[model samples]
Target: MEKRNDPQLRLGEEFFNQPCLSLAKAFLGKVLVRRYADGTELRGRIVETEAYLGGEDRASHSAGGKRTERNTAMFMKPGTIYVFPIYGILLCMNVSSEGEGAAVLLRSLEPLRGQTLMRELRAARRKEGAPQLKDKDLSNGPAKLCQALNILRCFDRRDLASDPDMWMEREPDTNPAEPHDIVSAPRVGVESHGEWAEKPWRFYLRGNPCVSVVNKDAERQSGSVTDNVRSLTCAV
Candidate 1:
């Protein structure tokens, strides 16, 4: 177990300087830590990820190597955070991977520390008044997780390896997730990309309630609709 005051074991730049697909799969079960200005820390375990290959991949914002203000972070060094807003309302988080133009979107996570803060932020963003939020509902989607954690546009292009506010860590004693424990499917909300939409780039932990979308088999077995419900698509 990690000590309360000890610095978390963060994944370094070298860890993310690999193929996006590899990094996407490896992200599962790792912990995402958010250290606020007041020193309050929030934690969650990554449960789902989607890989976007570089320029050749039509679905990627960096496709065709076109550089734009909105996608500049996607070309930054590995381990950089690429945050962007969708519909001017929701924020999505992704980590730059490989050398350039490739990244892995963080699709969902299981809430770990600071549940109350996550609930408060989530409730504050919704139209309805304060209400009970189930653990799974707290951070089951990319945008939802960002809102629950108060992650905003300011975090865009931040270096995950060195950023004081946000970073990813792995437990020293935790075993890597086995093949049977992972599921890969076409990325969510990328059908508009034609052939690229069929690529099984979305990876999620099998049977993890925190995953945004459960595989058909997992959903059928779970029976509880909420447990395996798919999240609403906001953007890629």
Candidate 2:
């Protein structure tokens, strides 16, 4: 994949050098770009993300400051890619943020380019008898977006700021999401982590159809907790 010549469009280190929670919110409305070896470019609008506060985040892979071969990317500098497997076969993509081992999980994306290719890639991964995927379902979840974008374990540890094959860019046509347009709620699939599971660490664009899940009750309950968690985690 060739590097994009327009440096102005690609996000730099400064964009990612923020606290995990801040980065998670900031990711909303941004554009994630992936370039294939054949020069096929796939683009998506980031719609949902989750923050993991490193050693203090019990649900994080690097919980208790524990490091392993699989999770070293979480300890890397901001903008480092952290691709990890789930359910033994599927993968999820995250980006390291400020603080030791802290990272932001990219929970969902709205496909903006290469829809046909994204659908093809996704279909290739489905079982032979599985139903065909609709456009709305192409990249609307963590592992689903990975499949749509062809994000494999080999992408782990790459620098999103400099990687030729993959990078993030600001949304060229839209303003950054206003606070009122961003929804905060507890992260998904982390209930086993005790109280940490209830932290309002997951963020998404309000009313975005591509978001993986929309929990209205959770959002209503998270108002105060969101402010508390923000004060603790947004200090950078």
Taking every candidate in turn, the Cα RMSD to the unseen true structure, in Å, is 8.0, 5.0
Q: What local distance difference test score does each model get?
A: 0.87, 0.91
lDDT of 2 by residue, 122-236 (tens): 9899899888887779999999999999998999999999999999999667788987678888999999999999998999887888999998976665555667778888885
The worst-scoring run of ten residues by lDDT in candidate 1 lies at: 227-236
Best by lDDT: 2
- Candidate no. 1 TM-score: 0.88
For model 2, the stretches where C-alpha displacement exceeds 4 angstroms are: 1-5, 221-236
Scored against the true structure, residue 92 in model 1 reaches a CA lDDT of 98
TM-score of 2: 0.90
User: lDDT tens digits, residues 119-212, model 1?
Assistant: 9899888887556899999999999999888898999999998888888899779998976577878899988999999888899988889989
In candidate 1 the C-alpha lDDT for residue 53 amounts to 89
Candidate 1: list runs displaced more than 4 Å.
Answer: 1-8, 217-236
